[model samples]
Target: MTKNFNIWFKNFHAGIVLKVDVLIPTKDPSKIRPRLLQVLKGSDWVGEIIIETSKPLSRARVIGARKCSTEWIAMFDDDVEIPENWFDSILPFIQLKDILAISTPSIDVNNVHMIAYKRVMDHFRPLEQRDAPFIDNTLIKREVLLNYNPSPLFYSEDELLYRYIKKHGKWIHPPSCGVKHFLVMKDLVKAAIIMEQLGFYPLYKFLRSRVAYFTISILAIGYSHTYKTMTFFWKSNIKLMAGFLKARVNKKGII
Candidate 1:
């Protein structure tokens, strides 16, 4: 468990009056958690350090945003490997006059499943010129997030929320402010189960399309020549398909 504390600091930007609060949404403490803490706590501009353990990313981010009393809220995932000067890199994008939220590119560090999964997902939901869909590493204004109050589903809630915010304001993706994402499969499996219980999948929006995902899975497996990569893709697809179908059979709406 996290011993929560609030720290105050003067706004760090030269011309901009931006006060930032970093929200870390984590369910369990892994090796990544301590590394993440080190990165986030090192920043002088980050004011509030809110650690929400054992909560969905969607719910955690929403709760964290509401608690934030700063100009910006950074809903960072706990498993990310953040670079030094992360704040400095993101500050300019967040400080943009019209940007409601800003997304940073997440580079896959070592997860083969993530690398393959990302390739498949890109076909279903491609990145927009002005916006990046994922909120795993994102910066948003307090009012914008609170006003939208995103209702996320089983998966790709970040994408849904990004589209929702895009309607009212701008979302930007800058390459300079990228973070390394480690996709742990156990966590993904748990999250998928939770999403099924919440009744958010089976709809034909975002990552709700079973056919699209399945098709990509087949393609991913067929394209890979190595045994290890093929096995990883196969197992991943089987698990996802099983969860998706189970949810669809249980519910009567939007399968």
Candidate 2:
């Protein structure tokens, strides 16, 4: 399967000069996987495999993507698992016109915060377009990406890029291209992220931003998952809100 797929894609992209640079932005180097690096480096379609580290992951990603000279870039978080035929999966969409970026929804965990987020996103997920770009594993054109610079935000940073693509060109998401995603969506991690994105907002805006996740659907997720899980789930929510309020007072996150 691997050998034939390689031959097929080499033929498929025979005349194409465009290639992808794998950009990985991480704070903790230990999370970086050798397997992912190996696969990307071994692939013919990949040019530079750059790893960059900086504060507030968004900034780290921007730096790595900016430094690459390739016309296309594939950005991945430290936790993502790259499939063997990853490039093959994204080949068809690359042939389309006016595609500024391409991404797939993350294969999410069934935890409380993650499940709730998935439910909320599903309500607004577009028929043809995905609601948000999963930056963890995405293929995008570098020229189009350089136009919109993401702020040094820990969360909702992708929102800036997503809005631009939605307005300007196609942000195609091929279902076959989904990657394994590992994110800490509960407890302190979740709280820190919310604080970074929402701490400066007025009371009403902060409340409004979080209300959707506080639904009965979210509560039921805990119940169905188990009573013990529900207790921890609410605890995480409490920690998140409390941390947000504290950050609101301090004007920063985890400092």
Best by lDDT: 2
Q: How far off is residue 68 in model 2, in Å? A: 1.3
How many clashing pairs in candidate 1? 1
Q: Write the per-residue lDDT of candidate 1 for residues 224-248, one digit (tens) a residue.
A: 4345665565566567666665665
Residue pairs with backbone overlap in model 2: none
List the candidate 2 regions with Cα displacement exceeding 4 Å: 1-18, 109-130, 176-178, 186-225, 243-255
Query: Model 2 scores what on Cα lDDT?
Result: 0.67
Per-prediction TM-score: 0.68, 0.69
- Per-candidate RMSD, Å: 7.2, 6.1
Question: Each model's C-alpha lDDT?
Answer: 0.64, 0.67
Which candidate leads in TM-score?
2
